[model samples]
Structure formats: C-alpha cells, structure tokens
Target: MELDCTAVIADVWLMLDGECDESTRARLQHHMDTCSPCIEAYGIEEKIKGLLSRKCGGDRAPDSLRDRLTLEIRKSVTVTRIETTEA
Candidate 1:
C-alpha cells in the first residue's frame, strides 16, 4: 500500500505528543518501517523539538533583549516585503 505524505505529516504531531491511539501509532510505525524518507524527516523534527525544548524550556529572557529582537524581526519583515514587491 502507498503511504500518504500529507497524512503522515498531519499525524506527526499527534504521534510525537503521544496523543495518537494505539492503532494509529501502529499504522504510522508500520509505514515508517519501510519508508526511509519519512523516518529521516521524523528524526529531524525530533531533534529540532529537543533542541528547542532545551534552549527555551526554563530560561527567562531579559526585557531589553526581547524588545531588541522584536524590532529586528519587524525590520526583517519589512525588508522581505520590499524585496518581494520589487521582484
């Protein structure tokens, strides 16, 4: 049977969070057993989640840093919009 990539991505969050029922987990596992690309994608996502959790889990950000980051992001967005419009 061919596996649906859309369904797999949609269910990935549920599977990672342990919210999927046993049957759904089994089905996903069965697909992963034979699909290398999906397995690689899942691994990359898992690593990203782990890194984010470790980075932002308990660190309290300073207000000054937060404000600076917000300003930088807004500037970046404006630049991106201008570039896209010119293109």
Candidate 2:
C-alpha cells in the first residue's frame, strides 16, 4: 500500500512516542526514508521532543501554572460533556 503525506503526518507523533504498531511504524519509516520533506520534518520533531524531554526532566510546573492548566482541562471536559449530551 502507498502512503500519502497526510497519513504519514498523522502517525508521525505516534511513531515518535513509541505508541504506534510495528506495521504503522515501519510504513512511516519507509516513507521517511524515501521522502525528503517528511524526513526533515521528522528530524525536527524528534529534536524538539528530545529537547523538551531533557528540559522537563528536572523541572516542575509552578503551582499557578499547574492550577491554570487544571482549570482549563476541567473546563474543556465539562464543555465537551455538555456538547455530547446535547448531541
């Protein structure tokens, strides 16, 4: 099966996060091996993820920021629940 750019892009993150199935990961890697643009994007994303992982390792989010994100998530969940019920 031929892979399109959209499909490759969609699964790139899952592949990076080690969450994708072997078949899908192989397909993505095959595309990256052949496609220059996808390879470049993949490299950039990998670098960014690595940088964030290293940076976040010994750091913690301040209480204020954590509280704000918590509130936002809760609000988002509530809104989604209400929309689901309406639907």
Candidate 3:
C-alpha cells in the first residue's frame, strides 16, 4: 500500500504517539525515509512533541489545559492547511 504526502502527514501524529499499528508505522517510516519534505515535517512535529512532553513533565495536564492546547493545535493546523492550499 503506497502512501501519499497528505496521508502520511495526516497520520504522522498518530504514529509518533505510538497509536498506529506496526504495519502502519512501518509504512509511515518508509514514506519518511523516501520523502525529504515528509522527513522535515515529521522531524519538526517530533521535536515539538518532545519539547512539550519534557516541559509538561510527569504530571498530567489539567483538563482545561489540555482542552486549550487542543484548541490551539487545531487552530494552528487550520492555518497551516489554508497556507498550503494557497501555496
């Protein structure tokens, strides 16, 4: 099953969170290996996740905090989608 850039981008977060099955993860990895744009994109996301995790530390974020973060991420993704479409 070949994956396109959009498909890989859509699932990259799930793979990073270890929510993807082994097969799906393998497919994503292969795409990342072959696609320089995806590699860059995934690398940026991974770094952001890592930084957030480290800063947030061991304790779970409060529900309000999580919700707000989710909203922010959604907004950012929306903006990115618009920019990509324009480009």
lDDT values, one for every candidate:
0.70, 0.75, 0.82
lDDT of 3 by residue, 1-87 (tens): 888777777677778878889999999999899999999989999998899889979667687985676567656766787799999
Select the stronger candidate by TM-score from 1 and 3.
3
lDDT of 3 at 34: 94
lDDT of 1 by residue, 1-87 (tens): 555654564456567868789989888878878888778867876787678779898675697985686566556656765787799
Cand. 1 TM to true fold: 0.59
Residue-by-residue lDDT tens digits, candidate 2, 19-56: 78999899999998999977887888799878988988
TM-score of each: 0.59, 0.62, 0.67
* Lowest lDDT 10-residue stretch of candidate 1: 5-14
The backbone clash count of each candidate, in order, is 0, 0, 0
Indicate which candidate wins on TM-score.
Answer: 3
| Higher-lDDT candidate of 2 and 3 | 3
For candidate 1, the per-residue lDDT at 55 reads: 87
Which ten contiguous residues of candidate 2 have the minimum total lDDT? 69-78
> Which residue runs does candidate 3 get wrong by more than 4 Å?
61-87
Tell how far residue 30 is off in model 3, in angstroms.
1.0
